[model samples]
Target: MIRGDDGIRAFFAGLARDWRGWRGVRKWDTIEHDLAIKARHTGRKIRLNFTLRPGSDRDYWIVTLEMVIPPDESLDRLARDIGELFGDL
Candidate 1:
């Protein structure tokens, strides 16, 4: 299990506009996963790996949550929000 949730939250708390990458993140922040690239990016603006879905053409600006396992958990507020976003995805 990850340590203090605060750290994770803090890690991804103050992210500006996010970009949709190989993974479809729900948080719209950032989620890194090089191994699960092709298997996840399905051009749906959302993915099962917990990230913002990608589109055939970049029309919408998606803010990626970045990582399901936040690096910094100190920001509980952000963490909770990120988790909810994942739930929505």
Candidate 2:
């Protein structure tokens, strides 16, 4: 399981890099695009739930991510980055 804010950022950064590479392929239409990440914050923690389906006939790839946030840390930048990432899609 991914832990901490850095892990979360790295995960999304890697995903975005790979996604950009995939977009360059001519057969990109064949790639599965059904991906969703729902983030919920409760108290000092955040839970990120991810659902991805590789194909219409395939089962979903589900993941639950929980991160502990230090009181001094702010999530505004992370939220913006996530919004921009999804906006690109």
TM-score leader: 2
Q: Model 1, 16-88: lDDT tens per residue?
A: 1222334433332233321121112334332223334444434454434333322233334554685665443
Worst 10 residues of 2 by lDDT: 22-31
Candidate 2 regions off by >4 Å? 1-33, 60-73, 86-89
* Residue-level lDDT tens digits of model 2 in 31-85: 2444445444444444445555555655555443445433222444554475555
User: Candidate 1, which segments miss by more than 4 Å at Cα?
Assistant: 5-16, 22-39, 50-80, 83-89
Structural similarity to truth (TM-score) of each candidate:
0.22, 0.39
Positional deviation of 77 in candidate 1, in angstroms? Answer: 12
User: Residue 17 of model 2: what lDDT?
Assistant: 39
* Model 1, backbone clash pairs (residues 3+ apart or across chains), number: 34
Q: Which residue pairs clash in candidate 2?
A: none
